[model samples]
Target: MQAHAVIDHITGWLKDYHATAHSKGFVVGVSGGVDSAVVSILAARTGLPTLLLEMPIRQKEDQRERALAHIEDLKQRFPNVKAISVDLTPSFNTFAETVEVDESEYPAKQLALANARSRLRMMTLYYYGQLNGFLVTGTGNKVEDFGVGFFTKYGDGGVDISPIGDLLKTQVYELAAELEVIESIQKAQPTDGLWDTDRTDEQQMGATYPELEWAMSVHGWNRPEDFEGRQREVLEIYTRLNQAMQHKINPIPVCEIPLKLLNGS
Candidate 1:
């Protein structure tokens, strides 16, 4: 489908979801990244009161400044969307201290930490949503969520609604461009910003989004019969992520056990 149609489809979907749920509005976390930027714009255009949250950790001066600036810019364009900033460093540090596992045992500790930040931000959103009446809007795209299972299960993955869950990374960028998000963020490297200085999402995933996106379109995860070597490797990664994060995609497992015997035998 074309990018314009995709954006309209997602916007309509979100509007329908809100109407059915009787939500007062929408809440979106803005990470100074393209995905969230596009989502914020989409939410605002839906005519629902949207909230853009900036939850920063012990980020560098430059990073924090940029994040705040992005929030301010959104505030100007989206008067109905309230932009707020909250520092989450103390909470994350406390959570880290409470966990017993060493960093080596979990090479992805940084990712875990980042997930904690995401989750905390979600919790904050929920609290505000409760008081103000709004549903939490997820910023995850299909590429990040499906290709590498990059989201933190209950953390970033927890949401009342996901407007861009089905769009690939490339598609998301295209939509962002159409939405006219700031050039810097639209062209910035994608990162979860979990640690002081961390590798980009592509770096950690071991494959760039463009390459993985192509493989996904061609193979569709389960791996076709013709793939070989590196192609097979990429397929495996994608399949593992899809399978591993299946729980996040579907929170409840389906049970098919019989409640009672046909004749009470």
Candidate 2:
């Protein structure tokens, strides 16, 4: 991809969108991942009042350091940029304490809590967004947002505009390099940081972004029978996830009343 062109296009698009929305600026949750790093820079490039939020809930040290470093870097480079760190660990603990679950439902409870972490961050971002008239800028990429539906519904998926949602994971790294994103973040493994353990996205998803990208490309046009070995495995993983996450990928279902019923026919 033409990195420079894409960056310029996104920056301009953000500026135009902000003006149209009549909002004060952009608000982004910086997670020290490549996706968020690229997006925060793009938002800063617009020269609007961009707020970078570092809301950590039991975050790892390395991740926290990288996030702070990126925030400082942006503050130094852009006068319109403001950074804040809100520790949500206590809040999360309290929430966990209040919720009750059976031992048999351990797996579901763990997954629910993980998703709740994302939702907590989302709520924090919007809290500041409303306070500052800033739009909640999303940092999701094409692969996560559309390919496999890897994001949490109404959680990290909540946002006013997704500046980098069109770019693939590889393209996101390309843009990160072009934008001079901090070396630490660019080098770190891609993670959602929702769980306590530092599990990389690949480990959790059972497929690398590049592998998933290939599957996404030929999902409809090709079938698993056409491939062999690991190719088939990756395709199956992609297909299964895509099918399971349709609720997140598609619009919410709404039941419409029949016209005859409404007319009392």
Candidate 3:
């Protein structure tokens, strides 16, 4: 991957898009993850007003610290970069209380609430974006956004534009290194940061990003029988997720009415 060229292209694309949309700047949710770090820097590189929001809903201490550090680093490096720290714990708690479910369905309820956290952040990002006439930028990388469909629909998936959606997980790290992203975030484990428990993306997905990447590349033609042990296991994991997440991966379905039915006498 031509890291420097890719950076230039993405930075140029951002500026052009901003001009085309007639927007003032970009707004990104900084989660202390490599993908978000890379995106924030890229947006900052455009020399346009960029707002980095740290909306924490009971976020982990390390994660929150990393986000704060990155935001501060960018603010120091770029004059146009601004930072906002919004604590959404109270908002999330209220919403959770309003939608409380029975203990019998605790497992399902937990998943729903986790996803709600993401949706709340999405709303917060848009609030700032609209307030400042800036585009809401997504931090999802290709592997999570497209390959496995690991992101939450209409939640983390809700954004005006996904600048790094075309790059794989490993490639995102490459870009992060090239862009001089903070060492802590670059070396930290990749996570969705949606659950209360310290669960990394690999733990939830049952496979590492590298394993999933290989499976995604060859799943169309490769069969489990051709591989052995871990390879077969990873392939199965990837295939199952890729199939189960099709709804998130594909465009929303719309029903089309027949012209004759509409014009019926």
Count of clashes, each model: 0, 0, 0
Which stretches of model 2 miss by more than 4 angstroms? Answer: none
Q: Which sections of candidate 3 miss by over 4 Å? A: none
Colliding residue pairs in candidate 2: none
Which pairs clash in the backbone of model 1?
none
Two-way TM-score contest, 1 vs 3, winner: 3
Any residue pairs clashing in model 3, and if so which? none
In candidate 1, position 135 carries an lDDT of 92
lDDT of 3 by residue, 116-203 (tens): 9999999999999999999999999888888788888999899999899999999999999999999999999998899999999999
Task: Put down candidate 1 lDDT per residue, 54-140, tens digits, no spaces.
Answer: 888776665566567777877788778787787888887888889848878889777667777777887987887787789988889
- The better-scoring model by TM-score among 1 and 2 is 2
Model 2 agreement with the true structure over 233-258: per-residue lDDT tens digits:
99999999999988997878899999
Cα deviation of 104, candidate 3, in Å: 1.6
Deviation (Å) of 173 in candidate 3? 0.7
Cα misplacement distance, residue 59 of candidate 2 (Å): 0.6
lDDT of each: 0.79, 0.94, 0.93
Residue 155's C-alpha lDDT in candidate 3?
93
Q: Which 10-residue window in model 1 sums to the lowest lDDT?
A: 218-227
TM-score of 1: 0.86
Better of 1 and 2 by lDDT: 2
